[model samples]
Target: MINYNPKEWFTFIFRFHKADTFRKLFPLMIAVSLYGFILAYLELEYWSLINSSYVKNLSLMHSVLGFVISLLLVFRTNTAYDRWWEGRKQWGALVNVSRNLSIKLAGYLEDESDRLYLSKLIPLYARTLRGHLRANVNSDEISDLVEIDKTHIPNQIALRISGRIFELHKQHKISSEQLIILTKDIDVFTDVCGACERIKNTPIPFSYNVFIKKFIFFYVMTLPIGWVFSFGYFVVPIVVFVLYVFASLELIAEEIEDPFGSDANDLPLDTMCNNIEKHVKEILN
Candidate 1:
């Protein structure tokens, strides 16, 4: 995600990042402005609908719909944000679980070979999971460790980690109670993966998303029809500004809804995975 100082309000206003909504919406904003200007000019010069009661009443319709659209956008942005935050929370849990497992293994394992094995395996699980979420698992990364199923790389790594722990218990390297304790942390690895998958697979309803886009389109398109009488030629900028605000909200929502992607606003899966590797190595090696 793009990090910034919250206090630098002026700097943000003056700066325009490539991912900023203004950049994405600028072309559409120009089109909307032209549309609004044409409608306003036609109404004022030729149609002479500026004084018509029907045209005046359309503004009242907009006033009511404006409130309704605000509520819908609020809910849309909130729902998307919830998904993004939940993904972050799941990754946060994975970081903690990796550390806990590594710490326990470091204390329980006596042999240098076993410690080295787990040290590599714990970080491999994190790296594999990061790749799985992005749907671009690197074969080189997987082959460097141990080969298993390619269909589900994370699950294969996780299975290997669990199997090794079980083998240690069988060989009397770690007792039955220590085995139980270690199993708890390993179990959480799958839980975190499943939670991330749920967020990735499921998304906001299709019908609802389409409806919001349609609502914004029609609402902005009709703004010049009614408000031209009041705002006159100035309706062009007013309509464009309104479109900018509403469209920007939708754009931001789309960017953040799938937090696993390469979007600048997405969760920092690469950094988190690297951190997991560093911590595991520090604890176990």
Candidate 2:
């Protein structure tokens, strides 16, 4: 959600402050002290010629470990992206389902009375779906459009919307065949709702999350020592830079994981719902 120019380093770092407050990097400040002490210990222990020679032999082993962790990090990032992409696809389906259901509801009920009834009801269904997806169903926000009376209380807002379709059938209005077709559309719309809820409620497994976090921290801690013999005090900025890259990616994955949250990176669900309402009303009018 951050619109950053590639040339702007200040903007990139500043963007993290605007992300989830609880996930900020202040807690990780301990890494600097930890890296410094660990690297200093490694330097002192390897001061002797024989010990330095042994470390040179261990260099190949360290290289192999680093390569493996790099691959694991890449895999972790891909898994996070899968969740984000799936959520976007579900929302795309929601857009199509809303349009189809609205058109069918209006086209089937051709009576002046029924058309007027559907004019209000179809948009209400979309608004209710939008609110329900966000878990912020504001009755008053929808009150001007839909008449939410006693019968609409407790549960089954969808059933109330379907009740309009049901009425057309009960009055010897729409034929049994026509009713079945309309009911199928509603069923698809319901599936859209359920799919969106599934993505919103479920998250990547916690064990994987814990493993990635530990892996990144351990990798970063060892990095300073890995370079101490070569870069000496220059290890500070290099270590910070590497850790920052790793942290930035971790932050990005976290942001997109909850695509409905208030974070800037979250999907623009409110805007999307409003657009659905606007387009539906335009088509009806």
Candidate 3:
């Protein structure tokens, strides 16, 4: 995620330089713009050729449709923001739950060795979660965080962690009663995982996505035509610039809505997980 700090105007713009990665695919934008321009030209040309009374009627309809599409875009942006914020809040909850689990394990396990074993496991779970959330389970950072023996940590490391937790419980390293208590806390983590996964895997429905895309194009298409009588060639850059603003904002909201992806705008899951490890270990140490 972009650091949440005050930035100079130039710096703020520079921060989004990475957004250029997406801008390279200008074909889609070009296609849309050409379609818009053609539609605008046809509207004006057809009206001039026909000299029908419908020109005034079409102007009224265009105004009404423009207002409606603007409202829909605003609503769409708000809904996307809500999803992104909720996903981030869930991870915030996970951080708390992980800390609580560590404290509970420390309190419940009597033997120092048992406590230490549980302590290590707690951070490993956090690391595992970070990797799994980002779909980087076999990553070196996760492996290093968990300190899994080379022989034991297989390619399917996520499954390995789950299995080992059960083994630890069954071996009486952690009592069944304690396991029951721990599982509740684990369930909180599980809920966080499920929620994040849901956001990552599911997007706004196809209909909603299609509607928004169509609306933005329809809105921008009308923009240059509406201003062309006054702005002429200036209409070209103005329309593109305005559309870029909306597109950039929409792109960011879309990126953050998933929160678990590798995008720069995604929630800092690895950083959060590492912070959890450091905090928990500090408590134990």
Largest TM-score belongs to which candidate?
Answer: 1
Residue 266 of model 1 has an lDDT of 95
Task: Write candidate 1's Cα lDDT for 209-245 as tens digits.
Answer: 9999999999999999999999899999999999999
Kindly give the stretch of ten consecutive residues in candidate 2 with the minimal lDDT sum.
149-158
**Predicted model with the maximum lDDT:** 1
Cα lDDT tens digits, model 2, 1-285, are: 544578877766546445644357645655675666666565756443334665445446657876877777677777777777876777677677667766766666667677665656655665676667666677886666555774322125567557878888999778788788878866766776676677778877889888878877877777655566666667676666666667777777877776765568777776766777776666565
The superposed Cα distance between candidate 1 and the true structure at residue 197, in angstroms, equals 0.7
TM-score of 3: 0.72
> Candidate order by lDDT, highest to lowest?
1, 2, 3
**Which of the two, 1 or 3, has more lDDT?**
1
Q: Against the true structure, candidate 3 has what lDDT?
A: 0.65
Structure candidate 3, residue pairs in collision = none
lDDT of 3 by residue, 14-92 (tens): 5535545346435656765666566456645553423445433444655687677667767777877787788889889
Higher-ranked by lDDT: 1 or 2: 1
